[model samples]
Target: MKTLPSQLTPFVRSDAVGALLAETLGHPDAEFTLSALGRLTGVSGPVVHREVTRLVDAAVLQDRMEGRNRLVRANPEHPLYAPMREIIAATYGPVPVLRAAFDGVDGAEHVYIYGSWAARRGGEAGPFPNDVDVLVVGDVPRRTLSAIAGEASDQLAVPVNITRASREDWDAAEPPPFLRTVRSRPFVDVMTGAVHGG
Candidate 1:
């Protein structure tokens, strides 16, 4: 499976690092303390602290001591600020947002994001992705999936296209041509289970 940039580099390998970068650097209007960041990222406080220190040293983030608590925010003045934000948005932003959108929806065995955005995130060079293609595997209702997709689209600020497949179809020894083709491409597993081709 083709992996994300964060998985390929020591500098951005940690989940906390990617989460912190995407949430703070990608959304400059937000600020967070270490504990809050840990909670948001589902990472431990010490891990968040280490990543924050690294980002602070790299000038990607700025930290201020607010009495006993330290608050962190993106460093807009940094030379790499804009580029870094774009990178984080492209690489780390979608999965988490999409995963959250699917959290309340029942009956989905797996959710995988494929096509353009996934391709780009997998290191294929291309124009900036304008749409997100999602493949939903299981017995989920089309209406429910569409609603979730609509919600995710609004939350992610990008158009979301959904494709549905039954678990039997997805897990077949030889999937149909379309499913085979989609599985052959790079994709990100939004839910926990391992995606067939990812």
Candidate 2:
């Protein structure tokens, strides 16, 4: 099968350097250059510059040359960067998981969390082999779902099981989508966050 596209328009998206740049954009800030931002975010310098430019165009950041160095600052209360940062964290930090899921779903749009792993503090237990149960909230493209399930199995070093759930069906429970009891140790860990590992 064809590999999927890398870029995605997620609920929250960030320029790779978004966090590093934000740290310096505020007043009374510490010094940070493109090189510094790259190092901080683990992205390359050129990538940081390009993303910074986009942020500037969106009026989220301001930039100028300050005697042989480019200086950047968050546009005073731009209403964009702050929220952008939050959105990026909520949206992107889970990306390693989400991306794995997305790959499994192969571009299917209707996946959501149902079990303990969905909890903010994580599930009742820590990460475990059986806690990785995932329910596809909508019709996941078979290929994507397969890919994500495989990645989760391999990279997470845990076993993950996939279930199909319609929007109405998945949300019917107290937790909203976990109607079935967990079976595998892998799945149990996923729900409990007991899988304890990436």
Which candidate gets the maximum lDDT versus the true structure? 1
Whole-model lDDT for model 1 versus the true structure? Answer: 0.74
Candidate 1 local Cα displacement, residue 15, angstroms: 12
Which whole-number lDDT from 0 to 100 does residue 151 have in model 2? 69
Q: Report the CA-based lDDT of candidate 2 relative to the real structure.
A: 0.46
Candidate 2 regions with alpha-carbon error over 4 angstroms:
1-31, 89-198
TM-score of each: 0.63, 0.36
**Could you tell me the lDDT of residue 101 within candidate 2?**
44
lDDT of 1 at 177: 91
RMSD of each: 6.0, 15.5
Model 2 lDDT per residue over 1-198, tens place: 121111211221333433434344422244456665555444556667777788678776777877887777667567665665544333223323543346543334444443444332222333322345566667766666676678667744555566766666545554332444322212212211222211
* Model 1 agreement with the true structure over 1-198: per-residue lDDT tens digits: 123344422356654477678668756877789887766555567777877998899888999998999999999999978877777766567776777778867788888988877665455667767889999998789898888889888866788999999888888999999889888987767753122353
Q: Which pairs, if any, clash in model 1? A: none
